[model samples]
Each structure stands twice: as C-alpha cells, then as structure tokens.
Target chain A: MNETLAGWLQILALVGALALSFRPLGDYLAHVLTCPRHWRVERLVYRVGGVRGDADQPWPAYLRGLLAFSAVSVLFLYAFQRLQNHLLLSVGTKPVAPDLAFNTAASFVTNTNWQSYSGESAMGHLVQMAGLAVQNFVSAAVGIAVVAALIRGFTRKKTDRVGNFWVDLTRIVLRVLLPISFVMAIVLVAGGTIQNFHGIQSITTIAGDHQSITGGPVASQEAIKELGTNGGGFYNANSTHPFENPNPFTNWLEIYLLLVIGFSLPRTFGRMVGDNRQGYAIVAVMGLVWAASVAIVTANELHSVSSSAGHAAGGMMEGKEQRFGIWASALFAVSTTLTSCGAVNSFHDSYTPGGGGMTIFNMMLGEIAPGGTGSGLYGILILAIVTVFVAGLMVGRTPEYLGKKLGAREMKFASLYILTTPGLVLVGAGLAMALPGERAAMLNSGQHGFSEVLYAFTSAANNNGSAFAGLSANTAWYNTALGLVMILGRFLPMVFVLALSGSLARQQPVPVTAGTLPTHRPQFVGLLTGVLLIVVGLTYFPALALGPLAEGLR
Target chain B: MAGSLTRLLRHHLAALRMLLVFTVITGIAYPLVVTGIAQAVFPHQANGSLVKDGGGPVASSLIGQRFNLPSQKGQPSGSPDPKWFQPRPSAAGPAGYDPKSSGASNLGPNNAGLVKAVRDRRTAVAAFDRVPPSSVPPDALTASGSGLDPDISPAYAYEQVNRVAKARSLDPAAVRKLVAEHVQGRTLGFLGQGRVNVIVLNHDLAALKRR
Candidate 1:
C-alpha cells in the first residue's frame, strides 16, 4: 500500500478511537472529581496520610497542599536517585550526579520528563520503577486534580472552596490512572515491550559479535509514560527503542495513549459546566491546530526539501525507524509535541527544517492542541478567556463565559498565565546563546545550532520533554537551568490558574443576557484558534526566523 | 508568625506521609503486579525476546546487530563483512548499535557533517553492493531513530541478496527467496510500512548456510 494513504488511515483510526472515548472518559472524569463518596482504597489512603477527605479548602489552602506535596515529591525523588546504589534492583549502576539527579527529580515531578541522563546507562531498575514511575502516576494525577478544581470554579458560585485537594488527588490516581495503566501495561508486554528485573546481559550473535542488552520494568513504565503524557524513556533512544515501542502497532498505540486523556478533557469540561457545546468549541480549536501541525510536519518530511542531507539521501530518512517510516514518525512527532507528551518515535533534530520547526512551534503554542491531560483543558480554557476578552472589546459586550464574567481581575490572571511561559522560554534560550560555554554545546553548527538551544528552552518551559536531541544538554549549566525552568514553568502558571479559579468562584453568577457573546458557537472556535496562532506567532517569530527559517531558506 | 510556621511544617509532614503511602502503591505494588502477570503469561516476550543459536541465547530478534570483520589494530572499527547481511548504519553510541547507550546521530538534515556523511555513505554502499547510487534505498543510507533498529526496508534487504549469495557461494535465487519470506507487511494491513527484520533474517541465513 502507498505509505501516504496508510498514514492518513492511521490518523483517521486515532481520531476515531479518541472520538469514541471522549464522552464516556470525559463524563467518567467529571464523575470521579465530583462524586460524594470515596472508594475503600481511597479512604485507606486518606486515613494513612491523616487527610480529611470531606474537608473543602479555599484556593490558597488548596494551593499550599499541592505545593507542599510537589516539593516533598521533588526532594524524595532526588534522594532516591542520589542513593540508588544502595537501593534494591540497583543493577550495578552508580549513583547519579547531584545536578543531574536534581534535574531528573524536578523533571518527573513537574510531568515534563525531560531526560538529560540516559536511562539504561545512568539509572538503576529500582529508580526507574519506584522513583520515576511513581511520579509518572502522581504528577499526572496532580495535573488532572488542578483542572478539576478549575472546573469546580465554573460550577460553584459565591464560594471560596474549590474542592478537597487530597480527595481529588487520591481519587484520580486510584480510580483513573492506575487501572488504565495496568491494563495497558499488560497489553504492551503482550505486544513485546519487556517487563523484567534482569540486569544487562552479555550476548553473542550468530556471526560472533558481542553485545550487552538491558532489561528492566519497561512495559509498566511505558504504559503510564504515555498514558500520563510523561515522556521519560527507559532507554536513551526513548520511544524509538524497540523495547519501549517494539513495532508499528505499539508505536500507534503509544501516540493514542498520550493523546487520549488530553483530548477527553474538554468533554469533561463541557459536562461539568453544564454546557456540552462549550466543551465541543474548545476541543474544536485544539483539534484544528493539532491537525494543521500534523499535515505540515508530514508533508515536510515526505518532500525532503530545505535539508541538504535529505536532498542527498533522496528522502528524509535520518533518525527515523524503518518500520514506522516517515508517516508514522511524523504523526508521532506532531502528536507528542502538541500535547506535552514528548515521547519521540523519531528524532526531531534530523528532520527537514520545516518539519523540525513545526515540533518546536507546537510547544511554543503552549501545547494546548489537546495538550497534557488536565493541563490541555485548562490551557485552552485560559486562552478561551483571553479570546472572549478580545471579542468583548470589539463587540462592546460584557465578556462572560459560562455565566462567569471576565472582569479585570480574571483577565490579569489569564494574561499573566499566558505571558509567563514565553518569558521563561525566551530568556532561558537567550542566556544559553549569550554564554560561550553553553553556545559550544551545540552538536550542529550555524543556524541549525541556534535551534538546538531554542528547542531546549521551549520544551522545558512548556513541560513538553522532547528535544531536538542535537543539543548536548547534560552539563551542569543546562541541567540546573532547565530544572529551574521546568519547575517555574509548571508551577507558576498553576499559581495564576488556581488564583483565577478562586476569583471566579467568589463571583456570583451573572445572568446570560443579550450583551453576552455566545461562546458555544463555531465563531468562538475560529476566534479562539486565531488568537492562539497569532499570540504564539507574534511571541516566537523572531527566534524562529533566526533558527529554522534561516536554515531552511539557506 | 510562629503559628504560620507551625502550619507550614504540619503541611510538609502530611505531604511527606502521603508521598510515602502513594509511592508504595504505584511504585512497588503496580510494577510488581504487572511483572507477575507478564512473567506468568508471556514469559518469553516479557523477558526480552531472545533468539537462540545452538541452544544458547544469541541476539534479540527485535534488536539490530553489527555484521563486520574482526577489527585490526589500525582499523578499530572493522569493515562490513560481506559474508553476512549488514544492518543499517548506526549512530547509537561511540561506535554504533550499543544497546546500553542507545541514541541517534541527532544531526540536522542540513548540517555540513551530515550532508557529507550521506554523500559518502551513498557512494560506499553503492560500491559495496554493486548497485547504482540512485537505486540505494533511503533506509540503507540513513541512520535509524534507534540506532539499534532491527528492521530495514524490504527494498534494502532485497538489494543485499546478490552480494550475500555471492559471499556465501550460494544460489542468488535462494537468498532472494529468504529475503522475501522475511519481509513483514503492515500490521492488520494498514498501520505502519512494509519492512524486513534484519536480525531475524540473518539468523535464518546463518542456519541456511550451515545446512
């Protein structure tokens, strides 16, 4: 069969799968977050932690609980890595260096999973399972928990309470994440993803060549790594590794897994706010951006234009797997980047200038094209607020969404949330380029080299963990700086989001009036999509022009 | 101030306790449960799908391997041995195809170094296989995503038949037939692309030669 047609069919299949799951999963999430009674296991967890499951906290207290949990998680993961040599399943791997350990800890805790250290060589089996995989479950739960609170802000009126953080956290993990991950992990093992505790083994081939192969609890982690939108790999090759993603079926499934929760979230939003069309409109905008990125990246790879190496090779085959070929790789790249799920079936650095640029551009858009699980819905909703504020200016109407008025206070929080990521991304990239030592870390020279630095900071700030890979980012400087960026980028936006939720919850519902714009219509989707593109384009155009645009044109 | 400090400390303690409890559930119990089932049900696959030669594990059918002449003192990186079908060029680690340090070359398509490498590889592969540079499959010339890619495009595999058959003093038709049998189509007819598993193909070829 023609590869292009096959690629389209795979996309259609993915879209079909996601569409089928949308309503049930979304409503299930809504139910999980708002349900009155806790499960027996959840009750046990709450009791063990001494958390009052029924006590609702105002937004500040909720924020404090979240911050405290995440802080403790970071410290624990760091210590785990630093002391892995003493841990069970250490597999003879040495303790990770201080800076790398801190970076890995923060990266996982933030749900970024931006791996600087090679997993097979640097980490023990124990750390991979206990430390990293644990965060994969909880950090993702944390993201969903935050979005649930924000959704509550829309549902409740004249109330300081969002919800109980402990209840939401426990329920999300025990009810949603764990069950899905268990089934998926078994399926992965059945499809040939390794699940074992064996260390590296020395093997001789038929032709008499020696090789050392690694074995660990890969399938279990692989399931959640994609399911949670956490992209850390058990091997340095990441999803490209045959052990993590063995075949085309596993490859397609991983892409679906990463995107499932993120896309389902809007339906959850629609269900919670008592307006399904509102959810549809948000999802429509996300779907449009995601579809466009997929098309551009796929087309760019097929043609092999703007890259001399591709021109010589007769196709853009560098850093791409044979089984997946161009189409599947392109699909994986776009989906991963669009959702802050940075598991790559192909390396972006070796892609055509246009293709690689689209991956970077996807992250620059704040990854809201059905983004990270809970983060995607909240990110797009925040943009929806900004869009309404802009729409209200032109129409001279009261900008109210779901009966919540977008007043000056709400607008400030939304605007700050929008601006924070770009500020960190640009400043971080700029600092990397300005320093000679950092500048020397680029694996490629010239304009393409500039892109490596830009891609790192963009991936870090958006919590999209995929890299251009040509950038040597394991140094003391990159690790520490990127670590800071990951934490700030992940948490700072949450602060504004939680604060906005608080402010929104405090406002009494303003009645729907003639002056209120009908945000549920297709017009709002178009307007929101336009605002998203224009905002990102304006913010990152100069930097892109210097990097991918220059290299491609040359 | 003292009251606020105490509250903060209390919050930290609670969070730490919760973290420990959750860790045991997700970290310890989750993986162990999955591993138990995986080992019980599909032990062969769960424990790295190792293909054996002479009743001992030789290589994983899933992972690609190097087929080169023994390295001389001057040529630390040995030349490709024509007796065996070579997998795609790898940039996994310092040498290539090192599973422990898996990665790609990560070179931008327009980099001078990459461009030159592609050019040189095309010429070298064409010369070695006794084929025109234009006929060289893209997979033959470019390094794979996982530098340890076990599969190669069917086109590349077919192109190697004549050379392998000649090196082994065997029938080209037999070698071609072997390559044909090894080519795997897309899963369920339309998921990825058609390809050949290099490791498995070569393993069978070694068996064929011995017979």
Candidate 2:
C-alpha cells in the first residue's frame, strides 16, 4: 500500500475507534464527576485527606482547595526529588540538584511533564513510578476536576457553588483514570513493554561488550503518561522506545489514548449542558483543526518522497524512528501536540519545516483542538464564549450562551484567559533571548536557535511539555525560566476559567430567542474555528514566521 | 506567623497523606495488578521479550543493539559491523544505543549542524553499504527518535542483502530470501509501515558459518 494511503487508513481507524468510545466514555465521565455516591476507594481517599465527598463549596473555596493542593503537591515532589539518594530504590544516585528538582516538580504537578533529566539515568525506579506516575494520575485528575467545576458553572444558576474539588478529584482519579490506566497498562505489557522492578543490570552484547540494562515498571507508567496526557518517559526515548511502545499497534493505541479523554470531553460537556449536539459542535471545531494539522504535516513529510539524491535523500527524516516511517510519525506528531501530551514516537525537531510548524501551531492554538484531558473541553468552551462575544458585537446584541449572558465581567475573564498563555510565552521567550546566559543553552545558532527558545516557551506556557530538544534546557537558565512559565501558564488560565465559571453560575439562564446565536449550529462551529485560527494565528504569527515559517521557506 | 504556619502545616499534612496514599495506589497497587495480569497472560513478553538464542536467552528482538567491532584507542564504539543488518542510526546516548541513555539527536531540520551531519551520514552509510548514495534508504541515514529502534525500513533491509551475502559467503538470493521472510507487514492490516527486525535478521546471519 502507498504510505500516504496507510497513514489515512490509520487515521480513519483512529477516528473509528474514537467514535466508538466517545459517547460512552464522555457520558461515563459526566456520570463519574457528578455521581452522588462515592466508591469505596474514593471515600477512603477523601476520609484520609480529611475532606467530605458529599459536600459542595463555593467557587472561591473550590479555587482555594485547588491552590492548596497544588502548592502541597509541588513542595512534596520537590522534596521527593531532593531525597532520591536517600530513597531505597534510587540506584545509589545522589539527590537531584535544587533547580532541576523544583522545575520537575512544577512540571509534573502542572501536568506539563517537561522532563529535563533523562528518565533511566537520572531517576530511579521508585521516583519514576511513585513520584512521576503518581503525579500523572493526580495532576490529570486536577484538570478534570477544574473542567467539571466549570461545566457545573454553566449547568447551575443563582449559586456560587460549582462542585467540591475533593470529591471531583478523588472520583476522577479512582473511577476514571485509574481503572482505564490499569487496563491500558496490561495491554501495553502484553505488547512487550517491560513491567519488571529489576534495577540496572549489565548485559553482554553479541560483540561481548558490556551494556547496562535499565528496567522498571514501564508499562504502568506508559499507560497513564498517555491516558492522563502527561508525556514524561521512563527512558529518554519516550514512546519510541521498544519497551514503552514496541510495535505499530501500540503506537496507534498511544495516539488514541492521548486523544480519547480529551476529544470525548466535548461530549461530556454537551451531556452536562443538556445538549449532545452542543458537544458535537465543539468536537467538530476540534476535529477539523486537528485533521487539518495532520493532513498538512503528513503532506509536508511525504512531499520530499522516499528515495532521492544524497543530500536530497534528507526528505526530512532526521529524528524519526524508522519503524513508524514518515506517515505514522506525522500522525503521532500532530496528535501529541493537539493535546498537551508531549510524548513523541518520533522527534518533532527533525520534521520538515512545514511539519514542525504545524506542531508548533497546534500548541499555539492553546491545544484546544481537543486539548489536555479536562483542560481541552474547558479551553474550547472559553474560546467559544469569546467567539460568541465577538460575534455578538457584530450583531449588536448582548451575547448569551447556553442561556447565560456573556456580560462585560465574563468577557473580561475570557480575554484574560486567552491572553495569559501568550503573554507568559512571549515575555518568557523575550526575557530568555535577552539573557546572555540563555544563548549558551541553545545548541543551534541563528533562527533555529531562536526557534528553540520560542518552542520551549510555547511548550511550557501552553502546558505542553515537548521541547524542540535541540535546546540544551537542563540548565538553571532554561529550567527556572520555563518552570516559572509552566506554573503561571497552568494556574493563571485556570484561575480565569474558574472565576468566569463562578460568575456564570450566579446568572439565571436566559430563555432561548431568535437572536440567541444558536451555538450548536454548523455556522457557529465555523465561527468558532475561524475565531480560533485568527486569534492564535495573529497572536503568534510573527514569532512563528521567525522560527518554523522562516526555516520552511528557506 | 505561627497561626499561618499551622494552617500551612495542616495543608501540607493533607498533601503528604495524599501523596502517600496515591503512591501506594498508583506506584504499588496499580503496577502490581497490571504486572500480575500481564505476566499471567503473556509471561515471555511481560518479562521483556527476551528471545532465546542457542541455549540461553540473547537480547530482546524488539530492542536494537549495536553490532560493532571492539573500540579502538581514542574512539567511541557503535561502528556498524558489515556482517549484520544495521538498524537505524542511534543517537540515544554518549556512545549510542546505550539502553540506560535512550534519546534522539534532537536536531531540527534547518540547523546547519544537522544538514552537515545528514550529509556526512549519507556519504558514510552509502559507502559502507556499497550502494549508490541515492539508493540508500533515508532510515539508514537518520537517527531514530528512541535510539533503540529494533527494526529498519524494508528498503534499508533489502539494501543490506548483497553485503550480508558477500560477508557470509552465501548466495545473494538466499540472503534476500531470508530478508523477505523476516519482513513483517503492517499490524492488523494497516497501522504502521512494513519493516524488518534487524536483531532477528542478524541472529539468522550469525547462524551462517563465516566464509
């Protein structure tokens, strides 16, 4: 079969699988988040944490709980990294440096998973499983909880209460993420990902040379890393590693896993908002952008063709795994970036300039073309609000969506939420470029080097953790800068989201009328997608032109 | 200060408890359960897919290792041995193909260093394979994302048939037949590309007595 045909077939298969799982999974998520009774494990978790699962809190209290939980999570993860040498299964490596430790803790807790340290050499099995993987589950749960609260803000009226943070957190982790990850992990291990606990063991190669083999609980972590949209790898190779993602089958499964929860959450939103088509409309916007990225990237990769002259043979295949080839690599690149799950089956850095640009563009769109797990649904909804607000301005009517008015107060929050990531990203990139120390962190010179700084900031500030990799980012300069960016980028938008949700929750639903804009319609989907492209496109166009566009054109 | 610290301590305590409980659940129970089920279902695969060679198990068929002549003075290892079908070029670690140091070259397409490296690699690989530079598959010239790609492109595997036949003093047709035999098709019909497992292919070559 033609490689292009095969790529599309695989994509069709992904869409088919996602279609089958979408509604049930989305409905189940809505059920899990809003379910009255807690499961035994959830009850125990809440009890041990000294929180009540049945109770509801106002938005302020909800935000406070979230902040407190995140604050504690950061402190604990930081301390955990520092104490690695003293930990039993650290393989006798010393504690991590203070700066890197802080950065990693911030990364994982924020669901960014921006790994500086190579997993096998720098971290022990204990830290990989207990510290990083645990955060994968919980941090994802936090995103889901925040989204659920925001959804409730739309569904309820005349009440400040959104949902209880503790209840939502425990339930999503216990019922949704944990169970699914368990099955996915088993499936991955069946496909030959290692599940053993043996530390680094020396193996002799066929050449009679000694090679050190690092083994850990890889399958378990690999499952959640994708399922939770956390992209850190057990080995530095990430999903491309044979042990983590052995075959093409597992490769497709990983892309699907990264997308399943994120894409399906639109249906969750629709169900919660009492309109399945509303969810479909939102998903339509996401699916269109996502498919376009995949198409554009795959074509860019394939255009140079398979066989050519010596230097022409480049066909832009520098950092891709051969097993996946160009087509699957392009598909995986688009999928990983479309969500914040930065796991790569092939390195994004080596893609054709056009291909790499699409991946960068995917992140620049706030990853809301079905974004990170819970975050995607909420992010798109906020964008929908803005789209509606802008559309309302043209029509000269006060905008109401899902029956709630988008007044000045709501628009203010939406504007801030939209602006926050770009603000952080551009300023951070500018600051890094200005710093003399920052130039040393770049391994490439000129435009490509400038791109590395831009990509790092874009990845971090969007809470997408995949780096351009050519950037030498483990230093205090990149680490501290990106770490601060990740934290602010993650929480600041979240704050705006919750605040908007609070205001919306207090509004009584406006009755439907002729002028209501009918957000679930096809025209609305078009408007949303247009708003998305224009908003993200204009905001980052100059930076993008300077980086990927410049390179691709050259 | 004391009051706030107490409040903070209480919050910290909840976090500690949260981390501990989740560590037990995620790190311990979750992994244990998955491992148990995986082992019960596919014991060989669950235990790293260690393929048996001769008497004892050799390496995993899924993981590509370097087939190199021993290191010479002042030089690193990972020079490809012409006897074996080489997998993708690995930049995983300091020496390359270090299981403990798995990663890519991480080079962007437009970087001058990358353009030079690709040119250098294409020249070296084409010469080494005794093929026209244009005939060599791109996978042969590029570093895999995970320096541990166990398979090479079907084109890459076919490119090695003549060389392997010459090195083993066998018919080129016979070597080509073996390469054809080992080429695994895309999974479940259409998922990934057609590829050749270099490790398994190399093991079969090791069976042929040297000329």
Candidate 3:
C-alpha cells in the first residue's frame, strides 16, 4: 500500500503541474479560436493561408477546413515517416519497412502508438527523435485544439465559424502541452531516465556471460508520449523495461505522466467555459470512474490464481517488472487504458481475468475515462449532452446544454460519434473470429484467445495502441484490418464531432431560466454517468461477454 | 443589442490577444524546454531507455529477456537458464518465445490436443525434475499467451532449484535462498502474489558458483 500511496503522490504532483500549465494554454486557445479576427499575429497567419479573418464560416466550410488540415497532416506525417530512412542515411541509417511506415503514420495521427516494429532496431536516432517524437506532441495537440474549437462552438451565442485550426493547434502545442512535458521530462531525467545517442554496448553479466545493452535518447520522447497520451514506447518493452522505468520512483513518474495531462484537461475546459465547477464535475465523474476501474483491475491482477493450482497462489506477477510490483503495474495499466495513452509497465495478457476485463471495459467506454486530448474532451461533451437530454426527458422539458437545446440533429451527431467505434470494433472482431486466417493467428484459444481478438479491436477502435503483446497481429490480415479500423475509428467520430460543433455553433444561446437544469448539479452528474454507462454497455455487452467476462468464468 | 455585443466582443478580443501571445510561448516554448532538458540530462534514457554492453547495444532493458539454448558443457549460460527456469513455454515455433513474434498457443483447455500437450508437458517436467506430476505447476506445463514472460511462480522456480543445484554441485539451501532473494512480493504488499524472477536468479546462481 505504501508503494501505491507513493505512486499516487507522484502522480498527484505531475497532475498538479499539468493543471497549472493547462490554464494559460487553454485560455489562450479559447481566446484565439473565439476571436481570431482581432489578433495581429493570427491575422498574418490567416492572410498567408488565404483565409478571410472576418468571414464566419458555416458548417460546410468548417468541415472542409477540418478535413483539409487532417488530410494534410496525415499525408505529411506519412511522407515524413517514409522519407525518414533516406533522410537518416546521411547520418548512416536505413529506412523502416513499408508496412511499419503505414502502421507508424496511422499510429501517431490517430493518437495510437501501436508499433509493429521495434524502435531501437527499426528506427534511427534521427527519425525516433525528430519524426516520431515530434508527431507524438503535435498529434495530441491537434486533439486538444479540436476539442477547444468544439467548446467554442458550444459557447458561442450566434457564430457560424468553429475556430481557426492553425491557431488552435499552435496554442495547444506551444502553451499547454509543451511546457508541462518539458518540466516532467526534466524530472524524469533526474529520476534516471536516459537521454543520449551512444551506440549499444556489450557487458559481461554477473553470470560471467556476455550480454548486450541498448541505449538512446528516450526521456524527451517518453515525456510527451505519456503526457500527450500517446502510447508508443522508445523500446519494445515499453514501461516494462528496467532501463525505461528503472526503479519504483521512475515507474510512478511514467504512470503519472501518462495520466496528468489527460486528467487535468477537464479542469482546463471548465476554466475556459468560465465555470470551474463544470470542470470539477467532469473531473469528479471521470476520476471516480477511472479510480474504480483501477481498483478492480489492481485487486484482480494482484490476487488471481492460475488454473494450475500450484501457480495461482501468488498474485499476478507474470510478465511484470518486479521493481514496480503488481499494484503499480496494475494502476498504470488501468490508467493508460482509461486514457488513450498506451504506455504499459506490464503485459496486459498476463493480467488477471478481471484486470484484463476492466482494461477492455475502459477502452469500450470510447476511451472517455478521461480519453485522448481532443477526442476525450469531445467524447465527454457528447456524454454531457446525452445527460441533459435524458434529464430533460425525465422532467418533461426539452434538454439544453450551455443554453443550446438538445435537438434531433445534435443527438444524431452525438449518437453516431458515440456508436461508430463500437460498430467498427465489433464488426472487425466478428470478421476476425469468422475468418480462418484471422482465427489461425490466435496464440491462445477459448476465453484468453477470445481476449486477443477483443483486445485488438478495442485497442484499434479506441485508438489506444497498447496490445496484449500475446497476439500475432503483425500478420497481413490483422495489419490491414486493424489499420482500417484505426483510420475509420478515429476520423468517423472526428467528422461527426465537427458536424456537431457546426450545428451547435449556429444555435442561438438561450438564457438560463428556473426550468434549466444546471449541468454541474449532482442530479445532472448522475444522469451523465448513467448515460455514459448505458451507451457503452448497450454497445459492448455482447462483445464483453464473448471476450473477458466469459473468459473470467473459465 | 448588436452594438453592445460588438463592444463585448471587442473587449474579449483584447484578452484574446494576451491568450494567443501566452499560448505560443507556453505551448512551443515549454515542450522545447522539456525536450532539451531530457536530452541534456539523461542522454541514453532520453533517446530510449536502452542498455548496451561490451559489444555495443544488445537489447532494451524494458523488453523481455530471451534465453535460447543450454550452456555448452563448460560455458556459462548466464542467469535464468532455460534448463532450470521453467521456460516461458513458447508459442513461437522453432525459435521459442521470440519477442519480435510474441503470442500464445491459442489452444483452448478443452481441446483434446491441448489437454494432451499439457499432460505431455506435465510428464516431461516431472521426469526432468524427478518430481511427482501433481507437483508440477500449470505455468510450467502451459504456454503463456506472450512467450516473453520474465518471471515464474515461486513453485516453478523451486521445482527447478533442486535439479539445477545438483547439476551445479551447489547446496540446495543456498540456491533456495537465492531464489527467495529474487522473489518479489505483490505490488503494494497486497495487490499481487509473491513470485521469483527466473532470469535474475539463474544469473545470480552462475555468479555465485563462479566465485
């Protein structure tokens, strides 16, 4: 318990730092997107892009700009990845495989860092440092910026434009994410995380045998990867590696970094909306849900006994770092899965039945247990809207969130955004289960085997890239299927969210009256929580039964 | 109403100016600063927590350790010998438990073939350690989904200690003590069970015997 407590303290410190940093960035983004017309610097940027600073855009124009930016980012990131090997050849390095290129580009843009290739062996220092790491920061910033725009749309009284993409992206990366990541990275280095570019070394082991050790500049990438909720590891072992995590302190630090940015974003959102309690309400609900999942996962993982009675006596110790132990690893696992961050300190496959179940459940919640930067906030917003809708239904009045009436169009957009991923995940998993080629890839059969398929779709659909590491998902079938799912899973919701924002932006802001239910009130919070559970539960119950839950009974 | 709203927008626009200015400074400046600190302070870890030995880099400290073969009659096999530490039963054929190809056997417990395989493994472990079949742990006989497991049950480690200690001509008690030393309690003292690291203990065995 001391270890868990210590880990929480470290996590709290990082969260505190992140919360303080989010304000200036959030306020700045809120300002730029809400009123880009008056800013001289923003005007120059708009002029360069041939965008009219004063012209307010309707839904179509807003959607076009959003898609254009996303498309450009994907193409640029893809080209960057493809050309990296050649670029690094001047530094005496070679290119990564074509398949890996696709996987990596998709991974970063979607905020999922599912690496089919090992970082140390496959990527040169330059690509690792410049290309991949840079995307980790920017991709998350993009998510935050989009969410900021959506928030602006919700708050605007009578506006057609959502916000400026460039400006929002810039402020998010510059003010909010970068500063917190920098301080956190420094603290991590102080805690013994490495940051260099020396070649691999061979050392004589204590056993009088030769062993080779690999090292490189990791702390910089790792900091933002976690802070931004991007889960790609500098090494394949991820947080499990002794060098990456090193000691208990470092273990706590890594997990803290993974969660702080994700946790504090709600607070930042609340501040931007001029209602701190709204942020606290969102945080409270998310934090409680996340905490409950962590507790369940940790307890199950720590206390599970294998079927082989002799092996089951101790807690879940398999595929975990001894230095960090089961509690810290379990906490890290649940937290990472809850957010879109996939940095893992232990193998998810080796987690106890319940632990693994909770992880999948968190992902199934659309990764909105605080979620990815832009996506998580937007996801919560959808839930908030749903909560108001349900409450209004109960009271026999029309629902209103931030004074905007919950209507057919808004609900449809929210419903589609919420439902699309589960549909993709289930259909994808179902296809894999039905196909012999896909089924043949299963390394374990029955419940555990089912878990591999479930985990793949869940990870891909949620854009949370950490895997069970027990499935042979690098196959052509998995690669293609998962890649498609990731692309669709990410963009579908985004498009719908942008649409929702556009629709909401056009609605005239209504004044709050006696009949208006305060969204931050306890009753509304309950409704919101219930809405999230029901929506997720309805979408994933059958799949859950077939995977982790059914597997637990066995 | 329109004029007042315009005035309000203009007032907020001033605040927006400060927001944009601060945003650029905080967003770009902060990440650059963090990356710089991380790069300057911990070069190796900053790059990626990779560990290198005498022959340049071998593998990451964060990844699973793979031990492929039995030591030659006199050559050292390093810690966590495959022979004594119940191998993380592999799903990767030919090259067992490869990190690059992580996976489980995907064989359900109900499969007649899987049952047969497990029984065969039980017999083999029992025969190899000269122990009862009942004494062999399931983790010993079964393959983990990911072949790259670094730790095993204390029972699994203990099951091999007698055989390994006999082979090395070391006292069983000393070997057991070493295993105990390598044992890690569950996280938070209550979250997980006690288990021993197969590789670290085996490495210690080799070192202790050498000295």
Q: List, for all models, the DockQ compared with the true complex.
A: 0.88, 0.60, 0.13
Sorting all predicted structures by lDDT, with the top scorer first, yields 1, 2, 3
After TM-score superposition, the amount by which residue A70's alpha carbon in candidate 3 deviates from its true location, in angstroms, is 2.9
Expressed as tens digits, the lDDT of each residue in A1-554 for candidate 2 is 77667778999999999999999999999898777877787778877877666879898878888888888889888988899988878886678899999999999999999988888878887788888899999899999999999999999999999999888887888889998998888888888888887777666666555666667889999999999999988877888888899998899999999999998898899999999999999999999999999889888887742212214555656777766778788888998898999998888776777787788889999998789988888899999999999999999999989999999999999999999999998999898888888877887677767888898999999888997888889998788888999999999988999999999999999899988899989999999999999999899999998887877676
Q: Candidate 3 regions off by >4 Å? A: A1-65, A89-94, A305-313, B1-70, B73-211
**TM-score for the A-chain in each candidate structure:** 0.99, 0.98, 0.91
Alpha-carbon runs more than 4 Å astray in model 2? A305-311, B1-8, B54-57, B73-78, B209-211
Lowest lDDT sum, 10 consecutive residues, model 2 chain A, at: A304-313
Winner by DockQ between candidate 3 and candidate 1: 1
Interface RMSD of each: 0.7, 2.7, 7.7
**TM-score computed on alpha carbons, candidate 3:** 0.78
Better of 1 and 3 by lDDT: 1
Q: Please, what are the lDDT tens digits per residue for candidate 3 over residues B96-181? A: 54443444444432334555666677777788788988887656665543445556667787888888777677788988888888
lDDT (10s digit) by residue, model 1, range A1-554:
77767888999999999999999999999899888988888888988997788889899999999999999999999999999999888999899999999999999999999999999989999899989999999999989989988988888999999999999889889999999999999999999999999998999876787889789999999999999999999999999999999989999999999999999999989999999998999889989998999999999999997988998998999999998989899999999999988989999999999999999999999989889979888899899999999999998886888899988999999999999999999999999999999999999998999999999999999998999998999999999999999999999999999999999999899898887889999889899999998998999999999999999898
The lDDT leader among the candidates is 1
Candidate 3 residues A1-554, lDDT tens each? 45556555544554566567556554554554455345465456444444444655565655555555545545555666667756632233456556667767777767888877766566666566655676687678778767876777777767777775556655566555666677767777766667655555555433334444555666667778888899888777676654456556666667766766667677667876778788778877787788788768766764563323213322344455545556677778888898899888777875666777788899988887788877788888888988888888888998898878889999999888877988898899899999988887876777777888889888998899988766788776787778778888887887888888888888898889999999787776677788889888988898888877776776
For each candidate, the alpha-carbon lDDT, in order, equals 0.92, 0.85, 0.68
Top-scoring candidate (TM-score): 1
